[model samples]
Target: MQTYNAPLRDMRFVLHELHGLDALTSLPYFADLNAETVDLVLEEASRIATEVLLPLNASGDAEGCIVENGVVRTPKGFREAYDVFRDGGWNALAGDPDYGGQGLPESVNKLVEEMICAANLSFGLYPGLTHGAVMALSAYGSSELKDLYLPKMIDGIWSGAMCLTESQCGTDLGLLRTRAVPQEDGSYLLTGSKIFISAGEHDLTENIIHLVLARLPDAPPGIKGISLFLAPKFLPKPDGSVGPRNGILCTGLEHKMGLKASATCQISFDDAQAWLVGAPHKGMQSMFVMMNEERLGVGIQGLGVASAAYQSAVSYAKDRLQGRSLSGTKRPDLAADPIIVHPDVRRMLMTMRTTAEGCRAVGIWVAQAVDLSKHANTEGERKEAADFVALMTPVVKALFTDLGFEAASLGVQVYGGHGYIREHGVEQYVRDARIAMLYEGTNGIQALDLVGRKMPAHMGRYLRRLFHPISNFIEAHRKHEAVAGMVEQLERAFGALQLATGQIAQAGLKDPEEAGAAATDYLRLLGLVAMGYMFVRSAVIASERLAGNTDEPEFYRAKLASARFFIDRTLPQATALFLAIKSGKASMMALEEAAF
Candidate 1:
């Protein structure tokens, strides 16, 4: 079995080189964070990931989680690991300082998340969901709610869950049947069932706070009538101690395809005592705060697992002896050369490497944009940052996961029969990454949102956020001799994305179905362009670093190589996707309802 190791060097390269640390440090809130401080934080986080979490991954997978007598019990060693995690202040890495948090920049914490996911994704879910829950509560929860729940949840004495999907509803929250009846004491009685709730029940925390979406008794039908509520598993007493158990119960634990150790529960709330987080009938507005961040978190999850699988594949290729190289006998003393020497094997390796690295850059860049959106000094800077984030969030969520699953499957392919076997662990990456695309509004829904909502948002303001950066970068570097070929390739791909975006937007106005038909491919096309842009940015940085005779020449050289692979191979797919987006909805909508 290949044990997980945090790719600290690559993480540093992405953070400090491609997306500068100064971006975060420039903010007044992040004034204390410099390269050295960030490096120390990452190093310590890497230590925990490699040492504490990695050792328990396979064990947890094998043991899974057990639900008995209404309480969920996580796999062996999970409780202890989480204790260490919480005590290490890992839970509050990017939390608010007012509530006993570290108050770090989100971009810094994003790398920590990637490391956790790569090391042990099942274990990471507990804190991952908690972080989202805290975001919602901090943004919209009443002062009382925040004073009571935020401190414990942020400190990890209590965990949290987002309860939105019910039995009859997934993406369509309008059809939900959950009801929150108003109480005489100013709270509500939440009576509903939320299905597929991650981290819904666990023994790792003293209490569990649930951010549920439900409807008021007097509410009109559909989404507008829906409201958000904060319900706890154990109600707190007047002294702030754990009191009586609330009405919420983990009725059952889901038998999943992957992340077996992460408890996904079917929660039943029979008149659960709850408090409203925001204004009545404004639940969706509050929930979007969590949803958007969770979307980015899901993308990071995909990147993490794919990175693990890629590392596993690379490690195996270097060690596994196979037939002689097609070119010649590279290892003359041995009967067979390693599979890595084969051209075909190298191609697969390059695909995994380029995709994983390119996606990392893209994900981190978005993370930086998120920090700026929240903390930038001026309104112009903040809105510009927000626009970029809105445009790329769907692309990151959909494309990163789509490519992640592909990369995981490629790992299985690279390992051949050994990959399918459980002990090797590459297959687990595939299984775990499979669900990211389905949850968090599904990749299909994300594509629809990108085409229908985000592109047309503020009369094309969001789309322009993406377009301007690439256009500016291209114009500035068009004459640079070192990267001329790469720039030319990126320019063509950027044009493809522009054409696809315009055609989809125009087609959507005439018939919404046209946008739906083109959405998935269009999102992928947009993702490729984003990846190209990141590659170009990285290449330019690497080119400058190499010119300075940096201490790490090989590192910069490998970055340039990855960029070349992305431009030459990956960027070409944009043309095909652009053509597909322009193909119209005729073939798609031609069939009748029963034509299948």
Candidate 2:
């Protein structure tokens, strides 16, 4: 069976040692937080993950969710588990304090989110969508709406879902046909059918608040006419009690390859009453806030699954004795040696380890920027942090998920035939991990956003936020004795990234197709370089700790080893990606339309 124990030690290393807690506490918003408090929080979260959530993962997948008589029921025990989760205030860990949240920084909350996702991704979806809704309402909703919905949502009494996709429209909102008519009392009556809505209808909460996108009666055609509306499963009375049911129903539940415990619903809205969120025709702007946050959350989901898969793979590797090691029979007392002793097995294990750890580090780095973007004292500092967050969003979303799926697949390979069957539970990781690459603005779209929009935004101001820091880091550490080799690799990769950036900028301006063709490769190149940067920095920190005679020598040594593997085995992929980008859209777009 698959088992997940939160990597709390590494999380601590990332939070305290790599990205200093001091820097976070320096911000006024996180001023009250200390290392001790953070450690306690992490320990408790780990307890919940192991005790409450992890046990439900396999069973939940087996049972899935069911919808009968327009009511959706999550897997057995999920409601109780959710109550435990919500009562503990896990849902509002990083929400606004004014809305009864703990107001924790994203830096800490993201690590907690990773733990939740790792333990049970389907269960995590319940609160995950709610958190995204809370963010959107907080950012764009009017005072009355926020007052009415934010508290209950943030407190976990209610859950939320994003309603944007339709049968004909997945990526192109311009094709959406959902319509909203203004009511006399200033509310809007919405009528639409939405598909693939995760956590859209579930019995876990008292009410499900849906942020729907529809066009006003007099709205323009295409994407420009789209508007965001807040439609709840049950309307709230004046005193915040659940009122009459709205004109929304879950018509059907999607049967999927994975995340079965999460209700992916076919929702029918028949003249549902909704309030406008932001201005008319500017729905994307408000929804993007939630989408961007969810994108990051999805990236963390990838990391979470990868981490769980790696742990399960490692456990199986150490326990499953296949054949004698190539070197010799290390376990002579047994029939054969554990597979971990074999070089090929080691390769797969190391790949999974390095990918998960590297993504975790990069996630934390971006998460710190998220904190700074909101809590920084100076406007310039906040703007710089925001730019960094914006530039790294797609990278985090695409890179983490792509590599996460790779790691999960590798886990299955490590488990051999046993991995393919449901008995071992590793196959579930493969199925669950696949979806992360497709949702929250598919990785392809993420790459295009990185290349087409963000790459050229404000004459490449966003690029500066990333490139300058990495450039300075490489230059400063080029001659450092402890990590000189890794620094050298990072510098070379960064050079390739720089060249690719310039090429895309110049070539894309002349021919957009060139940029379109190179988008995916270019995004990978940048992501690899960013991860390489993190590994090099981690090595430096590990070296310092080892030199100082730290007690946790094995942990530091493992960090150094993972860093070396990333630099030696993984970072070199930058060369191939760069070559692919340099090749441009010629051979890619060369084939005739009828060739396929």
Candidate 3:
């Protein structure tokens, strides 16, 4: 009757089979996250996703966010759903325990993130911002600020917002014109206009904590002049009670094509009382504290939307008996066999499955990398993990989202005419997936950052660290007959990254355009190869699990099948990218200045 929701089977496979969930608890920080606990947590999350959130998704799209007299209203059932969500401790599931969070490992949190987003992406945005807000404060806020805000935020009584954009600047912070002035009371007066602020202002919580970015009067030109501030919707009194409204107010809302239920705000502050978040002129660093986390979260959004579309399409294909089977269906009693019996239908479903499952594995690995980076005892170990995050963050954001949109489009194609209609909700997925690529630094900027900044960070330390695990995977799996083709493709792509790096290092020294031209597509290639390795890993896990005693045989088998589909069907694209990256910028740069 209802549409299928949340890829729980694949998620569990990634958690237990592809990775050693039971063994990870030996690490002190993760000692509490045993396999049983993980199962319990994920199972409950699945229920909420199917019951509470999924029902509200379409209505949220139809209603969108509403703004009146500086107060914002979420679509029909969002507040109630968010209240249930917060009461269930879902917002703080991946947060710091000292601030009232569950303090689970990033591995545990990502599963919850996937389910919630797949259910109602807009409903999740409210807490999603809160999670980032709490993370920012936990990482950089002073004791007074943390003491005053994180509890209420953690409790879901308050939400968090980050204001960093202006009319002239989206990704280029150097061009922003917002201003903040210091006061004698150890606070700053922030006056600026910020656009596209997600969860910028909402009624889901009693108060909203805004981490605002503005340039001070003495601030230097461009981004170096900027500063970060902790400005809340309601100024906190000495006793931590909400006071009268602060100067910060929502001026308007963006009427976007999708995720309409999640309020995107245009807020203007006329000398709002704001406190410095981190060191002066280090505002970009603090906001990035949230942005990097949000970037990964946006990638999760991509995965989430893809899963939603894919699940619905799978169900639709099975039930819509519009076509005959290639093998000739035996359903003589029916007018036609299920569309899924057709090869074309299988291709669509398999495409969605492989992309979604592969992305899930990559996201899980990246999340673990972040957790280890935070909790690892040694500086060198921490650096290794941080470097992985650095190299992968942009790739995760750009490539995953790109694939996400593509998957969404393919999902619509699966449903044919019914998918294009508003009632089926496939088009909403396409609309939702589109923004992920645009926000939190466009894919173009992500590519440039990869080539210009990430590739060369710390004199190649990031790339070196990134290649370690990838190289290990290739070396270990190089001989496997089933996935050797996949590994060979990955090796070529990995080698291309190395080759491109050397070329960029040489070319960047002479001219920057060569590096820029190679970036975006290079990131895609890198992402594809990285995911190809994940597919190989999944195949290993599935093969190993199926060999041993297992209660969930079918689940494990499908995972292996999906991994094979990914490797055999998807990984070869890296060959095209490998050829292109090796060719290197000559054709791209050959165009004359006036040719356009």
Candidate 4:
């Protein structure tokens, strides 16, 4: 197994320099936080991630989970690792302070999650799901429900699962068949099956909390009839302790292509005891609490896996002896030079590194936005922050995962045959990353949401929240010689994004299918431009650091190089995406139903 190390320097740079962690201390909620405290927390998180979680990754993947007598048993070491994780208070790092949580900012949690995911994605899933459940219950559940469940879940003694998917329905929840009948005791009896449930049934926790979606008997048809329910594998007693087993059962675990150690279960609720969460017939809204959280978390999964892949690729490239440098022998003493000496290999490595760093920049930026949305002092500040969150969430989800898959593939390409083999682990990254683009509402769905809903939300308010900053930045710094090149490149890409946005919106106004056909390309356009925006920001900061005669000249210089590569090589892709969107829907719709 390849050992994992958290990118502490880069992470620190992002938090303290790029996002201005010190500025957050002004917020009342974060008044106690300082740079040193954040650093210590990050170092501790890195230690646990690299030491406790990474060692179990390969073994867990190889061994996987198994079911015996209807009980799902995780691979060896998972249970113990999870115990350590829970005991460390890692589960409550960002939970509500009122419910035994540390009450930290989401940005800190987001960064920590990236480390956890990079170390062991499967192990991270258990806590990841629990966090999502905690969010849902905290936001929408009744007071009694929160009191009964939040403590254990926040404490990590009990894990959580979001039960949404059914075999017949994946993204279309309106067609779901799950039903709930109201009981005289005020609790509902849930009857349904949920498929592809991550951390659904595991031995790592004392209890499993399931946030299920079901429909009431007298409810109207379609999505309006659906309701969210809080159901546990074991019903809680009057004293809030685990009681007899409820009507919930894990029917089976799916044999997946990757992350095999994470139990993706087929769960059945046969007249299970459940309490309604949120208002009736508003399950979708209730579930969005978890869905949105998971969407961002899933994007981090992409980053984590890709980071692992990139590290492996870099390691292999530096050590593996292969072709000589095109110019001449890089190492005369050796038969052939390391692959890192090759220009093409350098290009791939630069692409992987730039993508990871670029995505991290935007991901953390959005995370800060999340923090502001929830805790900003003024309503106006909160609204502006929320607008950015609304506009960029989909972009973050789709773009990061899409680029993540590409980076993972590049890792395999860098390694040649060795990467494809099981022993190398890069192949597992590719396999694991494949699902990220598919789940959490899929990349396509994210794109559609971006173009169809987010763009026009509140009359383009969200888009303006994002676009105004880039425009102001470009206008403010376009004349500066140090960052003129990056500013120019970013300006052009931003223009292309603006043009594509208007064109796609107009086309969609005429024919909705035009929007659907163009959604993916439009999203790609936005993503590239967004990354370009961050790269420009990074270039400006790097230039400032260089001008200040920073101690780490090499690090700042490398940041500039990465920004240049992204602006010169990657940002131009937005123009291509813009052209694709301009092509409209005729060609895409020409194919007949029988063509396939």
Model 1 over residues 479-555: C-alpha lDDT tens digits? Answer: 88789889999999999999988898788889999999999999999899999999998999989999997999999
- What C-alpha RMSD separates each model from the true structure? 1.0, 0.8, 1.8, 1.0
Candidate 2: stretches off by over 4 Å: none
Report lDDT (CA) for all predictions: 0.91, 0.93, 0.83, 0.90
Model 4 ranges off by over 4 Å: 1-3
Candidate 3, overall lDDT? 0.83
User: lDDT (0-100) at residue 589 of candidate 4?
Assistant: 85
Return the TM-score for each candidate structure: 0.99, 0.99, 0.96, 0.99
State the local distance difference test value for candidate 4: 0.90
lDDT: which is higher, 2 or 3?
Answer: 2
Query: Best lDDT goes to which candidate?
Result: 2
Error of 2 at 463 (Å): 0.9
For residue 309, give model 1's deviation from the true position in Å.
0.5
lDDT string, candidate 2, 62-104, tens digits: 9999999899999999999999999999998999999999988
| lDDT tens digits, residue span 18-92, model 4 | 889865779999898888988898999999999999888888889999977668999999888988888999999
Where does the lowest 10-residue lDDT sum fall in candidate 3? 1-10
Model 2, position 275: C-alpha lDDT score? 98
**Candidate rank order under lDDT:** 2, 1, 4, 3
How well does candidate 3 score on lDDT at residue 172?
A: 81
TM-score of 1: 0.99
